[model samples]
Target: MSSTKKVKDSHTIMTQLIMPNDTNHLGNLMGGVMMRWMDIVCALSAMRHCNTPVVTAAVDHISFQQPIDLGSMITLEGFVTRTFRTSLEVFVEVYSEDLKGTKTKCNDAFFTFVSLDEDTKRPSKAPGIIPESKREKELFEGALRRRDLRLIMAGRMDPKSADHLKKIFS
Candidate 1:
């Protein structure tokens, strides 16, 4: 397989208020809610890259390095890591900023998304390539590593599942 290098564009979304609804009684943002936001932002980035609707196929990794407090501003930044015929892999980084203007990276994750045709609900091919840069190359390499690990895990589960998983993971 010829590796198709994709140039990733950084996209960011700013959200505020970890919120009582988005948090526990202790007022820390719930991991699930944060993850959902990350998915949305990453999907947006993929759509921008592919110029088509995208759906989350899998979340490869998520790590919470710090806690986000209620009412703090949360910034989610996403970038394309790589692309296949019909799928794009994205990496997202979440940061928390306090009233005092301190910003810290609270979480990071890698997610795979597939572009879909609205009517057919089938995978759609993405653009050939974007503008290549050093950052894009680095992110693509990192995402490729994660993709390899996911393939290994899928292969271990079952042969049939691995075949289906390969289509999505690619």
Candidate 2:
């Protein structure tokens, strides 16, 4: 991997058509189905950054803003927000499109994945990411706080020790 790479270097996009199997009785896409799509797109972004296979470590703050109707077109875009030693966080935004081609943001989430070594099957170093655009910079900065929150929620980190989070509430 290079010393660092741009956010666009790991950008990933996916589109899916909502079908009966992917929907609930209400004809809206099932939350689990949406989550599965999010995971796939995010993993792609992570793998692009690391140049190695990656596994989902955690997913946080999944917001379902709108329901995707049956037969509607849905697009999910994911990019690496930041990369650490052997893991990275991806921001995925899901949009629902109508027949008229109008799109509405339906869901969004942050996913963390660990890069893996093919031979040893252990965590491996991941390339760092550089934010170029304003939105990318913002997400890159906030990634640390979001990662801290995930760790706290998972009982892997103490809330008091989250310096990035402290700055927000303080």
Candidate 3:
């Protein structure tokens, strides 16, 4: 695998219309429905980045900032922020657009995925992210801390061993 891949190399965008079936009785898009889309887009981005079968390891953070009503167009965008030994982090953002082209950010999330070897069903290395924009660079730097926090919360890493997160509190 190459040492690094540009952010655009694995970026993914999906658009869908919020229909009756995707909304609740209140006529707003359901949280689960939005999450499902987020996971799908994030997984696609991860697969694009790794060029292998990837599975969702964890959804680090997902925030529904605003409610999207039925009849709105929903856009989900995802890009690789950083990569670890066998896993990579993708930052996903969801926006809702009205008929007039007015856009509102509805959700934001970070997802982690691990690449798998098709023959062995084992974890495979992921390519590193080479940030192209300032925003991508910032996200790339923060991804390490986010990964440490996720590992600590999942009991896969010790709090004391999390250098990036430790600095946050200190």
Candidate 4:
């Protein structure tokens, strides 16, 4: 738990073909299905970062930018942006590629996961995360504010008590 890992070390990528079963009546990929995929990839990234079992604590932000049609290839990529004492934040992006290789960003989201003790099944310390790239660093910096916001929304923290978010409101 004393070791720190780079964001790239926990990067995860998954691809799935949107089939009839994965679509809604309009032939667009169902929102639930997209969320499922995001959860899977994000969990994988979180587990990789912690090197231990983890559980999804929350889905912080999700934006459906565009509709992905059936028959398209969907790619989901995720990485650990930052780590808390016992939790980690993962950022995931989903893209859709058409038959002709036309790609469009479909969704982006942030997920939080809490590392668990293998025997006790209780919250455990997670390894630190080091963001190397500019984008990774940006996300790493923003994660705390996002976490603060999530806590406020969940009633787990007071708005005025948020470290990063209070600056904006103040």
As a whole number from 0 to 100, the lDDT of residue 33 in candidate 2 is 97
Residue 96 lDDT (model 4): 94
Q: What lDDT tens digits, residue by residue, belong to model 1 across residues 1-170?
A: 22333454436464666778999777899989998899889988887777778899888768788878888888888878778678778888888999998999898888889888867878988655553777766676565456666766656344444453456558
Locate the minimum summed-lDDT window of 10 residues in model 2. Answer: 59-68
Q: In every candidate, how many clashes are there?
A: 0, 0, 0, 0
Residue runs of model 2 more than 4 Å from their true location after superposition: none
- Candidate 3 wrong stretches, greater than 4 Å: 1-3
lDDT of 4 by residue, 25-133 (tens): 9999999999999999999998888888999998976778898889999999999999989988999999899999998888798999999998999999999888998
Question: In model 2, what lDDT does residue 166 have?
Answer: 89
For candidate 4, give the lDDT: 0.91
Per-residue error for 109 in candidate 4, Å, reads 0.5
TM-score of each: 0.81, 0.96, 0.96, 0.96
Over 4 Å off, model 4: none
Error of 1 at 142 (Å): 2.7
106 Cα displacement, candidate 1 (Å): 0.7
- Tens-digit lDDT track for model 2 on 56-161? 9998877778888999999999999998788899999999999999999987889999999988879988888889999999998998888888999999999989
